[model samples]
Target: MKVDFRYLGRSEVREIAGGQALSFAPNLARSKVFFDAEIVHPLRFREAICALHDVVVGDLKFKKKDKGAYEAWKRDQAQKQEQVRQTLLDQARMRELAAVVKEPLPKNLKGDFQRMHRLYWDARNKWALELSRNDPELFRHLVPCDPVVTVAPDMVFFECFAKDESSYGFLGVDRGAFRTEAGAGLGTTNVDYSLALYEHFQTLRSYRPTRLLVDPSGFEVNIQGRTDYREEKIDLPASWLRGFGQLQAAMGLPSRRFELSVDVVYSILAFLKRHREKAGPRSLRFQLQPGKPPTVVLEPWGIPIVSHGRAYEGEKAEEIKVWGRRRLAPLARILPLAERFEVMLFGSGLPSVWTARMGEMRMVLALSGWTANDWTRGSNLDQFFADLQADPAAVDKLAGHLEQVRMARLTTLAEQTNVPRSVLMGSLHELARRGQLVYDFSVDAVRWRSILPVALSESMLGPEPAELVAGRRLAADPSTTVEREVMMARGARLVVANVGQSACEAVIDPDGSLTRAKCGCSFFYKNKLRAGPCRHLIALRSVARRSVVATTDRSDLTVHLMSGTYAELRAEADKRTVATGYVIEHAWRLAREAIQRTASLADPTQAAGVYRTPAKIPQSLSLPRALVEEIQREAARLDVSVSVVVEAAWSVAADQIRKSSSLLN
Candidate 1:
């Protein structure tokens, strides 16, 4: 599959030597990196990329923009807390120290109580010490710094590199037309010589970019422009496809999604920049009071930064915790240029997504709970599997709709197809992961992009971890059973899956992070849940989650999962208890209901097929009157539509004749 980028620039220019900066595949570690992003203005995007690069090198030094406000807020709260502490001491003295006149209160009591108030302020002060002061002379690794870049319907990936802890740089681009000259299912070559031709277009003084163009050919990549044209093969890694699918799985996971206006986003960014270093709180806490705009509480210091833009209209009162808050600094470059911003928090220390909406473009930053949960280390292997397989029927329907509209928002496509937003989102995500769907950030809709070869394996996303192999082996042993037990005593459903000789209990606190996690494994004992989950815990997480694979194209087929688990909305991780009778009864009832529902929607005019639905439409065949009358009689005898009666008779007769012919052969 060859794809090309055509330059819309107006000026004519002479060719020059290309720089070595843009060898995307060469610069990036293929095994470790794969993401997708779109840029509207190359220069502006270049600026943002440079800023992010500087941040990783620690060269873009920034003092907390809200330092003054933070300090004042800290002082004010401390004074108030001190007064409260004084009153509390007086009360203690009256209650216990009343008989002892010399000692008004316990000597340790005052000091301990005072320390409680300083928890907020002291943490704020420590933010500076916690900041990464190490300066890398060379960019070593782009672990937390990599951003996926795409040119809309076309493709362009820039992989930032680092030589040392401080040194890194790697990225590539198509310096021609965004349209493709080659067809899908072809090969692309990565030749560094394309740079010289790219320089040829850069010299075009009259060249003015009309808009970003992307002509995608599933196979090869061609760089076409007004003055220059080049062709080089591009390789689409399986993991790249899996990266999107895994992301969709996370998006479908249950989480707290909220909107933050540009101003509000800026305030939070500024707050973190100023106080995150000495900020008292390690976590960015969101106080979401029903009907009121969310109040962002700075860590440790307890300094409350209210939203200056939009209000929190959600009636549900929720408190959200976000870790790795400082990782969001890269967004500062684009947030100022964005029209809107939305944040999706998936429990504390889980993956949090920050989406900045530009008019026709979007910038998304998916940060793990910590910098260590890397894209390559595979902390989210479960998500990749869960999102890998999608409903083929939903995919077929979405493809048809996307073909007609070209691009549309999730809601629009969902409405057009009469499919639920959540259900369609699952299929779309799977399609996108399979490289069949191209996400258009400008329209905020997923576009129809076909597989170049028309067939690809799901395993391209890569292999499962060795830990899973061990866990699965233990789970399937005859002597052991990976039984899943659920309890809701603590308001959070607890899942326990036995592995080998020991078992692990895990509870995903709705607030984020495993609030109640205990495993007999030494990993858990040493880490105490801080270093991330053990392999055993990961296996049990799978058991706790249910799976559904659609078997047919019909709107509703006999959908039954193992153990007849209860499913969550857009979530797959919940499985309630199951009983034999309940399972049997529910299965029969749903099948019968689907049949009745299908019957009503079925059309009488459809051609003979296994299952095709359309409304009744009379047609003139101009057949013999005798045949027509006979057909009516047969239809009456069979008690079915005339079309069905005739079609069935013809089908049986044709089958008998074919069988007879086969005997002759």
Candidate 2:
């Protein structure tokens, strides 16, 4: 995805008589979203935006150890020590030479030395600043993309995905927090953000009257060829877009929601700051029981931070563990102003969202399962929406309704659309996946905000994983057998199966995720679940799922092309073409190859002269006069019989039928 940003001028803070004006230059290429309002709490807003900036620049991914780094460091240290010694010796000799000559230094020698030192420091600072201003590559390497800003009717929010691609931050300011002076449009756009702008944000204070402006006037002015008119093109990764959508979808799903006091969060942060763990099992274990305050047990140290907020009201007692605990450092900035913290835990080894509510403003930090397990590569999360087939009509209707209302709760949408709650849920998920809608956990409603101006489709997101594709193929094969499947506690299942030559065993959790898996294959041995599940595990899970699907009564299963079996059909086509018996066989081979390449099978009128002879079809279609004449002419031009051309057409049609009729039984 290539995103283009055209800004009239750089975003900056301008000093006024009694306040500051923070003007944000938005991307003109995006939909127009104008917002100009006086910030109610400038200091808190500054801290929150700065926290978002921290998230945007944060990269906690562990770097591989450089083999020669230690040696290089030692050499550099030795050189510095030698230089220092030489400098001291030279200074001592200069002092002795002066004493021998009996020529004393000037009275203002100390002042001269201090002045020279000040000049040198000034020059160095200027050079450093110039380098930062001139170097585009260095600046880009520092900031990946401008923070996405969306101005809704209800509130204004800024979203940013971290450079490591694991963490996501969203800061929302309610409409009540801003005194809107002007602007009527409401949409999402990118605001020009940089380290320099963040420095300007630090100047915000409670006494000063700070005005937050999206600067719609830039769009009004014509500056096509001006020097200040700047344009930037970013080759955005598809994985980044997918991660954004995945997090949005995950937020709307049912999760373990609880409130944690500010002091508990402070304790967790304090422990992390004091001690550094060097071993494994680094996680925050949440123990929740009915009528008891939630207790969070930090792993390895076994330190417990009990919450003093509300007691757990749910019936069952549950324990959930979340990793990537260190990413919570950014929350420390907002702690002073935040009233309370709300945590949403999807599940163990899944994403968790931590939101800090500060009166009218909220800052959300959504972390992936772990530092390395980014949302894009979390294949298990993708499985949750694999079976949710969105109805096109329902999606359009719901989108139309949401567009008019800006934001609405799920029940309100269901009541308005008169669509079933289940169907509407699927449609909303699909809308989020398409980047047309965002679920606002703060307000418990789905807001109409398009992440991208253009329409997004499934194809744009990227292709399915190779392991998933191969696994689906294996699952659809009748020869693949499930040896044993045992029911486990809490809706989990333990399954053992033979996938090809290897025996595989997997323990699936209640959420249909593989908690533990093992296989004889080398891929599984090498990567385990680090690179996602091996094909064997996926096949086993898919086969088990198909068995469950078979017993369920689903009337909505319509006849459609089973894309999974296309590979199988192509394989069979390859085998049958080895010893061709008739002209139809060659046509079938070509048709199958075309299907494999996802070519159009609607038109195959051209005569393929792989076979000289013609094959006849029983009960031939009675074509129109003009169409038959055209077919005859095409066959004649290609030096082939009419029957061969008709057979080629027939083969293509038959292949389409075969593809459409095949299903995962």
Candidate 3:
């Protein structure tokens, strides 16, 4: 994708009577966005912006040793030898010429040559420095894009992705922190940023007053003859867009959230600065338990740094390990101003977010699994969103609504749209994946912030993995059959499936991570999960998901039939009726009539309560034999009829479903 940025003038900090004015020139090619505010905490803002700049230029990937260095060394040695030989030859020739012609050579010839050589080098160095000053782009080839700034009603934030695509930064200043001077427009636009601007930010101090401006007046002024007018056109790679989307999506997923004191962060950084590891298992392990402070154990050396923050309120104990600890260096500078650090860990070998909180400002640093495992190439993280089927229409509807509100919680969005929370979640994920929205973990709400002027399309995210594509095809084929599924303890499942010509078996853990997989295909025999799951494994997973969905639908129907009112049961049964061609309503009517006829068989008082038609619906359901026997035993123990036991069981199941679904909100 090609993006064009035209700035009226370079962003600079200008001296005023009592303070400084920090003016930022935005991309005029995008929407006209402007904000002018008097900064309450200039030093904090400056450090946060400087930290963002560090992320913009940071590249931590290990580079191989360059062969050109050795070549240059060889050339230097050869040149020295040639110079020595030439000097010897000249001296011998000079002796012979002195014996023959006896004319003295020019006295100042060697001195003059030396002077000329020094002058030439000095002039060349000056020229190169001048050229670089004239064209800053020559030095910024790696940073193809600039930081994105969004001005919303609640706050203003700047977002940037690292050149290496391994780290992401978000710095937000709440509106309460800034006193608006002028211009209330709200939108997202690129700002002109450079190393020069970062240098200017260091001059900010608490003693001096500073005004922050996202200057839109640049768009109004004529730039026909302006000397500072400049334009840049960058052809951004697809991986850049894909990485941004992936990181945004990852932030919205459920994670283990905790808080750390500023002192704890300093301790971690201190240890990292002193020691260097040159071995395996370089990770930061988090030992968490309910009602206890978290302990962070540094790997390879087993050093522990316990936090002094509040106790963990999670239900269970867990140990999560995260990599890419070195990327936390950028946060060291802003530590003094930060009050505390909030961290969200998705899982071990997954992305994590660390947020530095000031009074009303936050600096967020999101790192991938490791330096080499960038967001774009993390297939394991990508699998989380693979099965999420997003409805385009619903996504558009939610996006339009969010645009007007600027920011909202998920429940608020669902209530307004009148759509199911599950479907709305998929839509919200779709919006986030396209870079149209950002989930703010601090507030647990989503804000409208478009990373690009235009929404990224599916093509811009690159193609799906070849294995996933082939697996989808196989799953859709009629020949593919799920042979057996054995329910194991602790929500685990053992699945066997015949995909194409191969028989595959896979063990899926409770958390959906693949524990074991085997297949007869050559792809599996060669690379196995190193190159991701084979097509057969993917097909088996797909078939297993379909089977689970089918079972869930039946279970949901049973819950509705036993506990729901007449109207609710009719609505749910009508949906199943369409698919199975069963006259569910007529079946219910016949069952009710049969129960009335058999009223004489039971106690007259109990029969009146069992045959009530308002709350309970008596419909024939094919339940598991074990469940039926359990219900019978419960009824016998309670000294009640089977109908009463069924109704009580449905109420419990419905309550559990409601509780589980509340987690999504």
Candidate 4:
């Protein structure tokens, strides 16, 4: 309820805040440190929070849950494993039972005397706090250097997560580094009291203090705009508040938006200082086109460099490739107070959206992949966005385009909401996940930000109506969906499939601006309606947006989005629902034995019962990506199901196409 941070003082804005005194791996449950103060950014937001906390999901282990389901949850426990092992040895605690080690009870004690020593002391205190947080030579210097602030009366949102929240660290701060105070306000503290309020805002950021008086009744609440701020509120997850509006709308999946300069970031920090032991798929690859310029390459010596300095206008010639190129070394320390360094790629391992700018300040960073993908796989920002559906008429025309301009250009609210600037960019990422909206980065537009604090309410920014979670998941179950109808001539079409596949379709639009509202989902071919309509097209367009579109012709309906061909839309929705059973006569007897074994294959991959009769017209082939990763690593090394090793390699290519079509007829 009280705040201040006025400082012009600027000694490297307090020794460029890389302040150290943080700690959390006392087996993570700390994060409450809300105000170890001082924050103002200018050194590329603390080297993009130490290059996204040097993306460390490192050395995690976990996997112990299944001593045969904890001996079948202790043989159905009615209670008695020595009377709950004497109530977990009298609520143990001689330093948590000498930090655990008694493991001899399963000598075939056919488990079932309840809470088996409280599930073996909660899996031995979660394997001794994941072996003391994966000891990188002794708990790798703890790290959660607590930063999850939120101050707002004009923006100040910081975030950090990883000790396996996969990886993320955001920063917002901006309202010219907010300053104001009257009564009292200062309560969140940790990380050695935020490095002692960044050593008293490093004497006003090592000297930029033109005037300073951040007095909330004084004890130092410093802020000299060069960056080291703190003010937190940890433990926030609803996918980290919808990853602050879907990971800053991953620069709306760029078809290439390069800009570079600052000498292509010192020629990528002199190719990571002459390839410091470069053993990687170490990419940076670019090669885009249109007007041409962005070459990059430096990968396993495919070399290429180019760019006299940013230029890939991109309309076509693409190549992208961008692996965590050393997490853009925190934009090379603000590329000498940057003047342009944007990037928005979407290729190799996904998620990469940098941007620097600096003048009026702008500092984005998204990253998501590399650092051996946090040791091979984990941070996939849940495929960014797929189950969309938030368009309360595009949040009432983005609250009437931020009440007529205070910022909003997605082509001026898709030309004042006739809607379709790729579906008003998922209704401006669902109004930037309900704090109504924000995202200026020095006017890259999207305003009506937030400042909510009169003791914070607006449903604490969590479930901002996406049709109340697709109507409480269609009222909890409603047989997990399956609607289908599709006749077309403009009237009877529905298709809803959820019990296995073919999910999404409901056309005969009475009102829903149904662009053949399809849904076969891969998040609708990666953000088509621009990520905002796929919960079976938001439950069949909220039942066709409550019927009333009177001038029909949504391209004569029947678009049917993706994941389809579900046994030919369930044998055409079982001939208009209910007639031929045995699952549509066993899916038309495997589609007439896959059309009489590839009906004279003129070249269905040079024939082989045309790849084993699994259909009548269910033809969709594209295998060899190194044989689908060797049939997905031999279906996870024979644990099975790469559709049973691709239908047993199409039953040995349908027994070598019935012995080569009986020696060619």
What residue runs in model 4 are displaced by over 4 Å at the alpha carbon? Answer: 1-259, 262-339, 345-354, 357-463, 466-528, 538-651, 654-665
**Candidate 3: stretches off by over 4 Å:** 67-141, 379-382, 455-457, 486-537, 552-665
Candidate with the greatest TM-score versus the true structure:
3
Candidate 2 yields a Cα-based lDDT of 0.72
Give the total clashing residue pairs for model 1.
Answer: 77
What is the TM-score (0 to 1) of candidate 3?
0.72
Q: What TM-score number comes out for model 2? A: 0.69
Residue-level lDDT of model 3, residues 1-665, one tens digit each, is 56677889889998876889999999998888999889998988998888888888888788878899899999988799589788999999999987977667789988898779868956654654454456533333344468889999989999887777788888999998887566668999999998899999999999999999999888799988775676666655566666665665675455888999888889988999998998968899999999998899999899888999998888789998988888998998899889999999877777888989888898889888788777666534545433556888888888888899999887587898776765776687777768788877667788888877887878776687678799899999999987776444344557778999999988765445455679999987964543357888888877777764225422212322444433443443344322110223123222333333432324322533445344345445443344455545545665766655444333323333323322111
Better of 1 and 4 by TM-score: 1
Between candidates 1 and 3, the TM-score winner = 3
Query: lDDT per residue, candidate 2, 430-504, as tens digits?
Result: 787777787777777888878777887677878877777888888777777777654444445567888877899
Lowest summed lDDT window (length 10), candidate 1:
547-556
> Can you give the TM-score per candidate against the true fold?
0.47, 0.69, 0.72, 0.27
C-alpha RMSD (angstroms) for model 3 = 11.4
Better of 2 and 4 by TM-score: 2
After superposing candidate 2, which stretches have Cα over 4 Å from the reference? 66-73, 76-143, 252-254, 418-426, 457-459, 481-665
Query: What's the lDDT for residue 49 in model 2?
Result: 89
| Residue 68's lDDT in candidate 3 | 100
The window of 10 residues in a row where model 2 has the poorest summed lDDT is 554-563
Candidate 4 lDDT, tens digit per residue, 97-181?
A: 6555564666656545444865774665465446444552233234233443433334444444444433454445455542332
Q: How many backbone clashes does candidate 2 have?
A: 0
